[model samples]
Target chain A: MIAAAEPIEPAPSAGAPIDEAEALRRLRQNEDQSAQYYAAWWLGRMRSRNPEAITLLCQALGQRQPRQAEAGVEHNAVARNAARALGKLGQAEAIPHLLQALDDPDDGLREAAARSLGELRAMEAVPVLCTRLASGPDVAGAPQTASSRLQEPCEAMLEALGEIGLAEPRLLAVIESFVAHERPLIRSAACRALLQLTDDSHWGQQLLALLEHPQLQVRRAALMDLGAAGWRPALEPIRRTLAENSLKLMALRGLVENPAGPHATRLDEETTALLAVMDELL
Target chain B: MLSPNPMAAEPTELIRALRQADSPMGLLLATRQLAEACHPGAAPSLVEVLGFNNPGAAVAAVDGLIALGEQAVEPLLANLDDHNYGARAWAVRALAGIGDVRGLELLESALACDIGPSVRRAAARGLGQLRLDALPRSEQTRLRQRCLDALLAGGGDGEWVVRYAVAVGLEQLLLGMDRAEPGHRSGLKALQELAGEPGDDTPVVRLRAGLALSRLAGGAGG
Candidate 1:
């Protein structure tokens, strides 16, 4: 897999430079939220592999002190930053601590933990993540806002499962249950997880069948899965959907994925049209 | 043969709910799911939702389109002429963020001509994100030079935001070029000049320019 681009690091000023020791010191002792936040950010930006840096970050990850919330959202700034830093550090040693953080009361911390665990590919955390998925929203402590649904832990859990790339039978069963979920997001996530777990061309056939599903979300999910799997069976169905303007972008993607496979000779007209677009665009 | 497979019908049921969704919130929710799925098919709908009045939904749509990668590029190009300028601007942004060479000319033209600050800003950033490495060495050098020239020419752009973008684009191009070569110094020199321009350049532009200059000086780019 292609590594994601590294973030641009801010340049250090000409004044007295703060070394890793100082950054660790500030992260450990700083009372100010903003100062500690910057410290955590810099540690990750520097991609510090130091054992001490990892320890300090883990400590920060477990810190529960309340800090200034960013405008509308309330979250543990230190823990969130630490989780992010740990992921960038790409240290497997940080996995256990991140797994512990998955149970953090703050949803944001839990979300960050789940993401880092995925980045680390901590397969051991899969069972716990599945449990979290089975459990519904932690409504009592969750942010009581309309947007909470969008920020739920369930989304992160699904994403982590996909990233881990484990397709255990129990996990597959759980994911399968959600494929027809009433919520489009969950259903879509379920489809993504299924693709990650199953290699059977049967699932690809099922996804192709879903191209005719009434819900736009399901159709979109099927298209996405087909593209990821490079399912050639989807080529014709994807081509047909391009007639619907709303589905064109996704259909084009499906075509891109299926291009010049065994079905190439059969898709002359479609391929010609697609190549025309590419030629025009390129 | 008599009993229908409940497993097979689940997708159809989900699709029904999505189509029947009544509220803006419902539509937004569905859009978010499709985006999260990274479904290329969601690109058109996501692009359509860019014209929606809801800021949250629009932002989600823009992000979703970007996350779809190269799949979203052609559709975004098609939407460049969207009747709604807001949607058109966002299409420009999604294409820019994807940084596919297919949209390079569109972005270049937008930076050179678009009246909206946001559109021009996105275009400038897009130019920086171009995958010059995919081209042959000669083409890479030629394209990098063209990008540098365009950014330098736009340094005097009236909008502070555009200038800030140009500084960033210059930094990106210079960093992407092979620093061992002698021509790389010219790009670095341009960045230094921008950083030193105290009066006309805003603090942010100057800050970016100075950062780029420092990075190049450190031999960070090879």
Candidate 2:
């Protein structure tokens, strides 16, 4: 008979398993570029609230190492990912540093910073972001080779504004113009933003129409967009979308419920309607 | 009546350590040791350690209280300190982890609006796993609906982690409910929504909700 295998330990994560202390050390010391990058992701992923971790991440926002693959571009992947982590760490202290990063020459880092500020819901960053958005997606330093989405932080800026909820009519008008942008990605993202900013079903209708677009990727993105829009009319369209169960269910729920709202002891009308729709799927 | 046990009167190592503890480090050491001795006698000291303002010691104390199971619920309740937010947070977590239905009201309140994400997450997970069978048959349905309501409300929690925990709680609540009930239909619909696209921004939340929905289906198949 074959010998029974002994159970030892669970497999390690894709990134090497480093304890909190080690992650902090690697991040603070800039042990190596690779080590530093992984450490930044880890500290944020682990939700480490260490003041030292926050300070190191903030410092990393300015570590401008040029991308070797694209030698001419001075964008730092390390700083970009570091900005992403700081947002996840939920420290308000990083907000000022992130705002400073918003004006960085590297649009990639700027995008990451915008995303983090949105995640932080930095209300203060709104006017700054609006100014940047007003400047348009084609900033002066952007590389011509990359697509509009990759070349600028416009898409990310709009998404962040939506996350923070834009009330300024000037910024809203800028986002509204992007609804007619040539790129499908930008157009879809604009619709999502408009929905959040305006809470208008017109944006939701545009999102539903995008759900029927030729590309599968655009449809998927619209499904997510519609979900975040929380427009009541999007529910039926989301259910009918040719997507997997996970996406369908998520979009439907967002239409009826706002996660940040007060505790629900009883089912509201929207929730009742949601259940009625779900009954058909069941 | 059953005969009383003399062993209950003997001082366990946890109590002895608590008496000997003179410093913060000593208290942590005592609390850590209490993890080894999971007895009803250690419950009070474990509850006391929650107010130590030491996360390490407090974590150990919470684990010890949880390990004491249903027995620790009373002391945790009686010692509820309204003034100390940290202690209350830790205590709420411990009570939720214990899943002894007696912690229902606390779990509901914590899930509703506790400032600490971790506390709310614990409450969400705790509310779902309450031992409904422990209640009288006549009362089980009402209690189950109460749990379902809290978990459903928790589904809207802003923090993805709390919402993820809410998915877990909902799945557990679903497991306890009969498939034909109106509550089960609403609860299951909420789970489906959590699993849906753009429903939760975090992939982890969506994945967990999807996994929860899958588990419920698998359980039904069995």
Candidate 3:
């Protein structure tokens, strides 16, 4: 059996500050702490959006902590934080390291990587994110089991991809695939992303199909996406969902955002029906 | 039937690379499903997860254990003191699912002292679940008082889910009281007021209140 990871050893003690030259020398020497702190400081600088900062951060990311996987310097928080900060910097240069960190045994480290990939809008990270979608939480080998620490960052990447926009064919396929993702969060994330990218494309049909998703919450997400995308074709599903008494009011609200068309008359009917039950809330 | 080593052919992959899973996330996904499949045998895994610092994993483990029934009692009780409020609260709910008398007194004690309103409500609920079977009639009075205290303490929760759980738990305890007794007469009235209050109108709360009211009606009519 390929057992799960052994406990990681702590990194070396905090040391005196080193100059960029000294840090570069230490990194080459395989001293974990020197490289780790240098990397963290570099990534932090990168997030500042200054040209000099971006250069420094990119340099840190390019350098490898070869000892990271070898000497088991896995508990190197500074090194891990640096990797995360690089991801957040959103530079295309950071993609490889960020992708590498996604496999981190540490949940926080993996998420930081995920977020960085998302923030940078690293389109190359899409394949990795897509793989994460399929991993589900079940696989022991996957970092989905790492910790709660990664959940938000993983979700963040999906959300970012949605807001970043995608082109046709591939965009529709990604949306269609994610609609079937086992995790509700991922499915919803994919739906939201698809909605953001919808235009003359056939995304309206995909969103309509998602309305029948097994998870009612996913259906709600699809409804919201359609409403936001102005996919007028979705009015029927949205209206149908709003009419169901057991469904949440938020879903109903999402469907009736426009309050016009078939929606105009249906909204009144649904409101009248819900009013009797939601009177106090209204 | 699924094989025990579902992902045997696939090597474990890195978390970051899970996106391009060599076996298509097969190994990672197999492990999660395997946890659920471990079912009757997964008790130990779930118990061990209670100590995990990761709230997500702990929550998953607890949910698995709760699904396993009475066998999860000892380990869950040990986790009642978990550092995370969510873990402790989930533990309390799992204990309620067990609904054993051994946990009744512990839950009652928890109501008076637990820091988080969610945990307090969960403990109160554990007591409520045990109401018909374990609680001695003499202890019922104190249970009523402690539950009401929790309702008052948990009144202003930012997460309406917690307040709703507390409200429903309060109502359950109230309904269980000996309404025929003059001292218990006002308990039902308090529950009725709390049930209709706008604060408890969330779908989750409304569902709980609906269930609680149904129980109360059954008690009154029976």
Task: Enumerate the candidates' DockQ scores in order.
Answer: 0.04, 0.02, 0.02
TM-score of each: 0.47, 0.53, 0.39
| Pairwise DockQ winner, candidates 1 and 2 | 1
Q: What lDDT does candidate 1 reach at residue A90? A: 88
N/CA/C clash count, model 1: 4
Alpha carbon lDDT of residue A279, candidate 2?
27
Docking class of 3: incorrect
Give the better candidate number (2 or 3) by lDDT.
Answer: 2
lDDT by residue for model 3 (B104-190), tens? 666766565666555665665565455344556667666556555545555445444345545555565665566665434455554
Candidate 2 matches the true fold with a TM-score of: 0.53
Model 2: CA > 4 A from native: A1-14, A68-75, A137-143, A146-151, A256-266, A272-282, B1-222
In model 1, the Cα lDDT at residue A116 comes to: 82
Please give, for residues A1-282, the per-residue lDDT of candidate 1 as tens digits: 111111123333311456788778788885766567667877886788789999999989877766545542236877898998998898999998998998777878888888788878889889888886654433321444766443446656775787688888888876676666555555555665576566565655666666666655566556655554455556667655412222333334445434323453222345444423321111
Question: What lDDT tens digits, residue by residue, belong to model 3 across residues A219-247?
Answer: 65565555444444555565554112112
User: Top DockQ: which candidate number?
Assistant: 1
Spell out the clash pairs found in candidate 1. A214-B15, A215-B15, A250-B40, A250-B41
Better candidate number, 1 or 3, judged by lDDT: 1
Q: What is the TM-score of chain B in candidate 2?
A: 0.85
C-alpha lDDT of all candidate models, in order: 0.64, 0.73, 0.51
**Candidates 1 and 3: which is better by TM-score?**
1
After superposition, the stretches of candidate 1 with alpha carbons farther than 4 Å from their true spots are A1-26, A67-73, A134-152, A200-282, B1-222
